[model samples]
Target: MIITKYRFLILSIMILFSVKGQSQDKFKGYFEPAIDLSYQVNPKYGLSFGVENRNVIYSDKNMQYTVKQIDLSHFSEYQWHSKYAFGLGVQYRIEHAFDVDEESELRFQEQIVYTPERSGFETDHRVRIEQRLYASVTKHRFRYQLGYTIPLAQKQANEPYLKFDTESLLEIAKTQKPELEQRLGVGLGWFVSSKTTLQFGVEYQLENYTQQLNHELFLLAELGIEL
Candidate 1:
């Protein structure tokens, strides 16, 4: 129907604007235009994929949408009516930010791997990020994500040549063994119709390292069209 098409068009516009006007203070960068598509694999299952320009227009490269982690989700839902429902899913995230500042602000570059062993993991290393950012706002709503990763898992390498005696040394050797960066986030979504949603969020990361600390904050925008 004509009404349905109009709604989709509006939802798309919301995706563009939400990224710019969230808190109205700390978010003054990046409106990276992106294209997103989704498919219904089964009666109740769905999948989605998206791509965005690295240099988002109106965004600061120093404080823009650079990624550190990601999450793919499988969810189950309950519908109270066409207008409202709730769902749950599990997610995991790749770690970003290697260290933090004395003030606890995230320093982006320090997040790069250092040390001999760590350099290998950092060299052209990629994020196999997995995370579950929940959605329940049948109406316009927002949610925040908070998480942390910490010191050595206390494990030894399977490699024979690099046999280390103590847990501390092995962990220290691999700069990858960073104390967890605390993850903080908040986003808003508007339900344009029964199956279309527009979302936007801002996230701040904190890291602690041997030398000093680092800080970085990002504002992210997303568009989802449910099948």
Candidate 2:
């Protein structure tokens, strides 16, 4: 059964890539790498810190293989119930820090996540609100994401898993009209040890879909560790 499920997942991913490849000329490619560390303070509370770096690998209008931004983030979560959790987070972003046109930003976030009891696959529903502060402007955004995790092997230290997620975002700023974006992602993850996980993924983003559509593709690598 697990093998069949894995085959289906692979076929679906291939189909998606094939369909999207038709418009590859219009898409920009980026690479993102990140690492996260989390500590469980108690049964109900947890804290996490993460850093992510993004670079443009292929783009028609922008310089290729250039540093785009780096983000430093921290979050705290409280599990209020078995199925629900609340979180607050802050992030500092350094935009084009390697170039002369460097800019900085601060963002604050509040979020809630719901995870029902596992039934074959685990699922998460998350809602988040963000306030972004730049040197000259402030913006507000709302986002919601649905994610699924499918175990490909029996529970063990070296288990493998598949993940799929979709997220919708709306941004509102005083200087510009509102914009809507959507993101779709698929990933494979491995439990390297009891406290370590590694993941590789691809995410496609449709930016400003309600207006002039911009297509972006991101290749992602992430490492997570629990303390």
Candidate 3:
């Protein structure tokens, strides 16, 4: 039990030291906007699609903005229980680069989610696995997210909520070394109507790379429509 309890902490401290030894720190900020749409065919099955665009700015001595990435994705979900669902998804992504070739990726994903009842506060958990295909490499990733939402108003349609979430990821590939990333976010979401929602948030990310660690802050907004 002691070993299990301290295993992650030990790993984190080691990684921190490793990252600190490499280079000086850098800070960056980003703005991301996304839209999603879903169709519910029945109580058990649904389909969703989404697009995302990301812009990053160097906030330090050099203040320049760049188009970072764009993504297009489609997914299908099956409800296994009243509060649980599974999904399969596919995505195409484009990443911009000035020095190297522009990178593109195809990703296939599977995910499961558990969400209990909704009242004053609701909590949810999600686990995901992905197979990522790049031009010269194939990678696999695992991610998990835990989130909570609290209703600002009574239990009614078209109400607003406050959301908080944290996520962690592990990536493995043959061409590149394994890496880990973590993110935390807070947001506000409103169900504008029976079939639509709007959300805006801020997120902080820490990513580990072969050479250095990356830290970023982002402002994000999303729109979801259900048909």
**Candidate topping lDDT:** 2
> Each candidate's root-mean-square deviation in Å?
21.8, 2.7, 6.3
Q: Identify the runs in model 1 with alpha carbons over 4 angstroms from their true place.
A: 1-35, 53-175, 208-211
lDDT of 2 by residue, 1-227 (tens): 74575565457556656766775436689999999999999999999999999999988856589888999999999999999999999999988466657658899999999999998899999999999998889999999998889888866769999898889999999998999998888899999998999999999888887877777889999999999
lDDT per residue as tens, model 3, 1-227: 43353356446545654664574776678999999999999989999999998887766646678788889999999998999999999999878453256668899999999998875578889999999998888999999998877677757777998877778999999876889988777788999998889999987777874456777778899999998
Candidate 2 lDDT at 224 equals: 100
Model 3 is weakest, by summed lDDT over 10 consecutive residues, at: 1-10
User: lDDT by residue for model 1 over 1-227, one digit each (tens)?
Assistant: 32352354345334534643442333223343334556766544444555443232233424434432333334443433333333443323223232122111111110111112232111111112222222211111122221111112224331111111101100121223434333344444555555665656554433332433344344566666766
> By TM-score, how accurate is candidate 1?
0.35
CA error at residue 23 for candidate 1, angstroms: 22
**What is the Cα-based TM-score of model 2?**
0.89
Candidate 3 C-alpha error for residue 216, in Å: 1.1
Q: Please state the error at residue 154 of candidate 1 in Å.
A: 47
The order by descending lDDT is 2, 3, 1
Provide TM-scores for the models.
Answer: 0.35, 0.89, 0.83
The count of backbone overlaps in candidate 1 is: 24
lDDT of 2 at 26: 62
Better candidate by lDDT, 1 or 2:
2
User: Which run of 10 residues does model 1 get worst, by summed lDDT?
Assistant: 162-171
Which model scores highest in TM-score?
2
